[model samples]
Target: MLRTLWKHVAADLTLAAPLLRLHFHDCFVRGCDASVLLDSTANNTAEKDSPPDLTLGGFNVIDEIKTELEKACPGVVSCADIVALAARDSVSFQYKRLLWKVLLGRRDGTISRASEVIANLPPPYFNFTQLKQSFSSKGLTVHDLVVLSGAHTIGNSHCPSFDNRLYNFTGKGDQDPSLSPPYAAYLKTQCKSLSDDTTQLEMDPGSSLSFDNHYYKLLLQHEGLFESDAALLTHKTSLNEVKKMLISRNFFAEFGQSMRRMGNVQVLTGTEGEIRKKCSVVN
Candidate 1:
């Protein structure tokens, strides 16, 4: 069912990126319980409405898969596990290689507040120190930070995501000097203004579809699209991780290990939460 849905929902990086992104958002807040899938009610705003998640797609994909699973075996599959599997398959399909083993039996949470997203999710403008602090606070290592950032290898980021790097960088009428000058000029053509939220730029220029270490190669060239991606070069620990990732032959294995660890963050099992009938709403 996931394979059939993958073709219709994600022929390119558009759907694949959001599936991975939604998984990350779910894992970071409330431990991959699918709290990120909850819909906004009249009394509350959900995480999906958060600024970071405002552009996130693939919500319907999750719903579609959940519907299929319910029809096949009622009250057995969890929305959380569906997201985990979808994220894995999306990367696997794009990379043309298997990535991770997503554990099952995760339950869905009933709460998803927008404020938690702002507090938990790191912005693209965060520097190395800030990014490290954010990930470390969540019990993730510097290794996870670099490996997961590799997801950028197959996604398109809105112009506003990295607008500060292009114009008004450091609150001045100039660009981020750290960004490659040629690449910055090229980005200027694609993203005409900081307010141009409609334009989406590929994070990895030549190989946006493959899930390899080319993102690291691009970072080495200062071609990383986000400030956080460039920030990897500034810190000693992350810099070493990047260099190691670049040289490591076991790319998929290492990524799979990290991905599984990330999926295990604050999970709900053994009657902690419920298996919702609908992924977008609590039963």
Candidate 2:
């Protein structure tokens, strides 16, 4: 079913990034429990409705996969597992082969809250210290932070996500010194202002649709789109890793390892959570 879906929907290339973002956002907030997939109730808001998650797409792809899974084996697969698989398979589009194995057996969480989104997931403007704390809080290492960030190689971020660097870096109408001046000038043209939320910019610039080491290459040039991307250079260890990844042929393997580690963050298992019949709601 995923093979068929890939031929149709994933062929567009744009959808792959959202699917990857969905998995990261979902895992970071509630430990890959698919809590991010839950729809908000009249009385309760979910992570899906949060400002940070408002840009997340590819839900239809997940729903289609779940529909097919339900037809073949009712109540057997968990939405959590589906999310993990989709994230892994989405990366396969670039390399034309699977990057890593997604260990399943995860179950969906019963609760989803918009309030948790901001506190858990690191924002685009996070500095190096803040990014480190965020990742460490989830049991991920600095290596994981630098590696998983490579996912930015294929995604589109809204103007609001990084316009601060382009327009007002320190609130004095100054640009961030860390940003490449020419790149920042180009970004100003694309983003216009912080209020321009509707415009989307390629996170990897020039190669947003392809997953490759070009992101790190650009990061070394200080052309990284977000403050968070530039933040990788603020530390010695992460800076070294970024340089290594720029020319490393083993990037795919390292990325797969880091992703597998990320997929294991604070996860619920062994009857801890339920296998939701529908991804968007509790059974």
Candidate 3:
């Protein structure tokens, strides 16, 4: 019942969607214990001395909604649980279809550090081997890696995230020469210049808002925008699994299952972490 209500509250705060997803991704990949959110600061470190973009972009919106939740439910609801609920609910809100069963009662971590973000988050230029290692480090299989990458289906990547792909890819940076001619041509147009905006690159061209097997379909057609995405197609084990899911109704089913599993990943629960008065800064 609490989880259900939190879902609605999260939807009322639209932009909280992605922030919530990221929180769960971090927890699931590591543990719900918030260790992943910790950063390394050798000496005295203040928030100002930390990374400027410390909070996830939409975290302010999430913080507002969380404040409302606190008022209504007081200490009953945990911020980590809210993060998980918001992630699943956000996807449902976007797709208008139920995908995952989210577990609740995850407590918030007291610690959050910028260095952790730099260490855990996968780099854009990461190849298949590096990605596999990263996922493995988190106890996830290659299949989980592929499915989670599908989150790109609903989110937008900034130009900085993919700039190296556009300007530095050996065969073709922005437009890979190996990609289908038409698709390559389209990407060339999309990423014409370094200064060109990348938020416009829709993961699924026709229906950017919907979550489906389109990302997999894109990989099949060689339209994957990032090297990490495109690499899924190169490995037979991972590629075949992704292909099977793309063709079957099981794609949605498995995606939801994977998402639920992701939500349960190493989260800081109980008294391990604090519920930040502000999602961006520790209280």
Candidate 4:
């Protein structure tokens, strides 16, 4: 049932990136328990309603998979597992050879808070130190930070995610000096203004749809879209890791390992949490 649903949904081509992002966000905030999938109620706001997660897509795809799982095995499969599987499947479908075995048995979290999103999920504007602290806090390493960042090779980011780098670097209306000059000019044309929220740019430029090492190449060229991306070059170790990732073979293997490590972040197992019937609501 999961395979069939994935086959049908994978036809979208665009869904893979967001599903991957959804899993990352879910894991980082509440330890891969699917807290990010919950909807806000009258009394509280969910992580999904948070500003960082507002742009998150592909919920309907997870919903479709959950519906089938519930019909087939009742409460057997948890939404958290579904999210992990969906992320792995979507990326594997796109990258073909890049596959990772997702360790399941994770249960859905009952709590989801909008307030926790910003502090947990690393922002686009984070510098090297902040990015390292953010990843290290989750028990990930410098290698994980560089390899996992390769995921940026495939998505589209809104202007607001990186606009400050193009229009206002230091509150003085200057562009980020680290950004490639030509790329900065090109981005300015597309982004228009600092407040432009509607424009979206490909993270890896021409190779946005491919899950490959093109992102590392862009980073080497000083063309990374976010400050967090450019931050990798700020450190000698991370910069060396970025150079290593330029080899597609090494990057693919390391990405899967990093993802597996990330998947285990604060996960709940052995009846610690309930298997949610509907991903968006507590059961």
> Across residues 36-153, which tens digit of lDDT does each residue of candidate 3 receive?
3333356524221344234344444455666878777776666566666656666666555446787776766655555455466666567788888887776677888888777666
- Model 2 local distance difference test score: 0.88
Q: What is the C-alpha lDDT profile of model 1 across 1-283, one tens digit per residue?
A: 6575558545555677788888998998878999999989999999999889898888888888888889999989999998999888887775555567777778888889998998988899999999889888878999999988888888788899898888999888789999999999999999998779899888888776666778888899998999999999998988888888886575566788888988988888888889999998898
Rank order (by lDDT, best first) = 4, 2, 1, 3
Higher-scoring candidate on TM-score, 1 or 2: 2
Given candidate 2, what's the lDDT at residue 107? 83
The TM-score that candidate 4 achieves is 0.97
Candidate 2 clash pair list: none
Model 1: runs farther than 4 Å from truth? 9-13, 95-97
Which 10-residue span in candidate 1 carries the lowest summed lDDT?
4-13
lDDT accuracy of residue 246 in candidate 3: 82
State the TM-score for model 2. 0.97
Q: 160-191 in candidate 2: lDDT tens per residue?
A: 88887777788988889999999988998888
Candidates 1 and 4 compared by TM-score, better number: 4
Of candidates 4 and 2, the better by lDDT: 4
Q: Which residue pairs does candidate 4 place in steric collision? A: none
Q: Which candidate do you rate higher for lDDT, 3 or 4?
A: 4
